[model samples]
Target: MSAGWIYNFPFEININLKAIDDAVRAFSVKYEAFFKVITKSLGGLVNSINFVLNKIPWFVLILLVFIVIWRTSNKISKGIIFSSLLFLVGVAGLWNLMNETLSIIIASVVISLLFGFPIGILISTSNRLNKAVRPILDTMQTMPVFVYLIPALLFFGLGKPPAVIATTIYAIVPIIRLTNHGIRQINAEVVEASLAFGSTKLQSLIKVQIPQALPTIMTGVNQTLMMAMAMVVTTSMIGATGLGMEVLIGVNRIEIGRGLVSGSAVVIMAVILDRATQGLVQRSEVKTDGQ
Candidate 1:
């Protein structure tokens, strides 16, 4: 080959590729250890919660959700929603699967909130950090959901932990972006007024900025919950059992009835969650504006 040809650059490219692979291998080892420790700790807490919920009668759980919805929204909507969920569960004949799906959704949301909110707050306070993180969040949001499954499988190896990890990544971007946007959009006059009143930065953030921004933040949370539900269903391809497994099995085995039932189950679950979370956001907005 001519020395001037692109193929003549093989030796240099080979060294670069090897270096990149070595770095990736090192990161994988560290990531695996970190993932294991965190998942184990959280897995215990999830199992404890699941055990408690399992002991409750399904009817009771449904009733509790109804009461929560009514308290947060209103009675009429709650009644309609409760009936719809009940009908869906009965028709799908997958009450247990629904519960399991609910459990995973709950766990993922809780974890996302716990981690996401603080990160959001931090990013909101620092413009430099926000600029740095914006591109990363964009990448996370735009990347194929299936691509997440590959690294998730490598790190956590195909189970609820991997499922939760993927769901969390897929669902977390909204909250961070919204929280940053909400805080940044706070009126300059309001912040100045707080400072004039001798409020500390922390005090201003908590008492003034956060209260005003609550609606936007809540909207972000609503979106996150919906995305989590969708991603969790997709995670079924990797052995995380739920409605997703039913759908996956149906597709693989060419069982039309199975696919329809499971797909409907997912749709029902999505609708219920979407309405509930959006209701919460609307209520929050009303209250914020009212105040």
Candidate 2:
């Protein structure tokens, strides 16, 4: 009848989470060579993207931004504004750092799309698979972002490779969820009509389903990109260099001004990406609706 006894469970059930950790670590060690190959490949990819971003003339990059935003939104003013925001990062002398961060984001998002989109499509086609995968997607999305870093670090060590891998895992859920939802939400009649018109399953899926689902899928892309951006500071903890690293360094040194500047740059980049991608989503929606 005591309050403690009433409120707390009497059973002392325990789960040996350490055993799971040990098992994973052992598996990673057993497949060390395979992991090394993956790490090397990812490292090469990150370096290549960083190199390409760095090689572009600052003005030309800005111009490219202008073009992208202008075309997507059909508004020159918004393009100019966002382009100016990007320029300020350069003016603040964080251009190279920005590129490094962008490289990681681009790599993570590309990888996420490559894997997640197809998996989403496959799951959407089958109820059994969809049920099986939904729980996994839910767990992945709800799991601590920090937790992804552990496996990544174990496999790839401390570098951009691990950062890319961790960031991809953290960001992939939105695309998969959105892709699945987009496909499933399409009108049944449309699919039936395509099949009735002598279309094979693959043809209907590619020609009709995908096009109809594209806008929602684009929303997922936007969300995934944003999530990838969110991981920048977190990924920096594992020695990934960029604006996030700058922020980390500033925090360690207790340099308020340095942290603030880098943090602002991160915000600016996020805003630019969000707006640009949202613009594309809006255009896609318009096109879909018009059709």
Candidate 3:
């Protein structure tokens, strides 16, 4: 025994890996069309993001983001801080790579929200679904990220599509879990009162439950974005392009400076994104508390 155990008489545990491979292969062939559809959608998004990021000059992109940040924040200081972070990204001489990384993260988060939000709503409404999905989400969250790439590669082949799909899968759990938690946490008394007042189920959900849950959901969104960013970088092993590639190359070559700089850039982006979304969470909390 590999473990050098004394229980050698237990019979050979020969699990046929070939059967699993054949099953997956057959499944992929049957669902090839569906896979292609997903591929086109994700590919188009990646292409669009890459094109715009490439076309836009660094200064203009930074300035535009700064303007939006300033307007949203209602504070020049916040905008300046975000802009400075952008400048750091630019100065790393890896703007294009960073842009590629950002594009994947954005695409993954958008996809996560599109799917996770509705599923979360469904889970919140149905106890059976909540029980069924909780274990799935827990497993997804607990599994090593590297494990995701295997099936992702099988489905999407390689490059950006697999990366995006893998990223969306890995990052989506927080949004679904937190959104469910948030909605479920809403006071039962409040829901009962809303229903008693002749509000339809849909109306109560739209007007009360969702509004009350927005802050917690946004917290989920924040976490999802962070996880997406982290995974997008990690997905470079399967042909993803971005800061992850830089880090990967550094690792392969044992170039300490290259890896550190690329890693630091990822950190800076994470911090900025975290802070911006944090502001949203704070505002949402304040509104909820005020009411």
Candidate 4:
């Protein structure tokens, strides 16, 4: 009465997953030089944040951030709200975790911009490259984010580096896509006019394209930041410490109060970052108005 034969494979596949894993481990060991370069880059970024956190008193850092956000936002109320939320994280006793989360976001965004912008520019220049890369970017954007952690852990090992490597991969697509779109969307007439002035390609790009694309680029950055935070809690599975870990521990212990408070602090951070970046985009538009 049970037809199990229809559902099962006809033969045993005998795939050696353990061997595959060992091969990957051997590869990482064999290429330590290549690995070290990336490790240093990731380490430097995370370490710089710890350096700042160690040197600055928490209250002083809050004041400084308030001043910068207030001035950049061009709104005192927005600054006050941001500062108050930052303080609330401390009151919630998640200040250290918040710092870890913030550092991770900043580091991932930095690396995203570092690689993504140049690759975007390269793609924008060639229809062939654009055609080839678009599908890859789509895959990177759509893949289950958790899938990144396996290779990330294999190559970078755990703790901050793999967490960052995973996050950077997860968050990088938006910047590349948006930057390429922004550059390509510029008026053909403007580009032609710049060349008519006998400008070299690099000159035209630096003087015209990037300035015009600033708003869109900033928007990509904002999206990347949000995406990075979205992954923070999940990345904690691989030795990351932050608001993510706080939530993880809370869940394991059935501590709903802890989970809610830590999660809310993350939301507050997201809002402040979102609003601040939006202000930058608006300002960029104003600057580009006449051009």
Write the residue-wise lDDT of candidate 4 on 91-201 in tens digits.
Answer: 988888888888888888888889999998889999999999999999988999888888787788778888898888888988998889889999999999999999999
In terms of lDDT, the poorest run of 10 residues in model 3 is: 1-10
Considering only N, C-alpha and C atoms within 3 Å, which residue pairs clash in candidate 3?
none
Lowest summed lDDT over 10 consecutive residues: which window, candidate 4?
2-11
- Considering TM-score, where higher is better, how would the candidates rank from best to worst? 2, 3, 4, 1
Superior candidate under lDDT, 2 versus 4: 2
**In candidate 3, how many Å is residue 161 off?**
0.4
Tens digits of per-residue lDDT for model 2, 1-291: 467867778677688999989999999999999999999999999999999999999999888888899898889998899899899999999999999999999999999999999998999999999999988988888899888888888889998999999899889999998999999999999989999999999999999999999999999999999999999999999999999999999999999999999999999999989988998898889988985
Q: What is the overall TM-score of model 3 with all chains considered together?
A: 0.91
Residue-level lDDT tens digits of model 3 in 59-145: 997787688677657899988988888898888898999888888888899999999998999999999999999999999888998
Candidate 2: stretches off by over 4 Å: 1-4, 14-18
10 residues in a row with least lDDT, candidate 2: 1-10
Reference-based TM-score, model 4:
0.89
- Candidate 3 ranges with C-alpha deviation above 4 Å: 1-9, 64-79
TM-score for each candidate, following the candidate numbering: 0.86, 0.95, 0.91, 0.89
Q: Count the backbone clashes (under 3 Å) in each candidate.
A: 0, 0, 0, 0
Index of the highest-TM-score prediction: 2
Residue 112 alpha-carbon offset, candidate 1, angstroms: 1.1
Name the candidate, 3 or 4, with the larger lDDT value.
Answer: 3
- What is the lDDT, from 0 to 100, of the residue 165 in candidate 4? 89
Kindly report which residue pairs in candidate 4 clash with one another: none
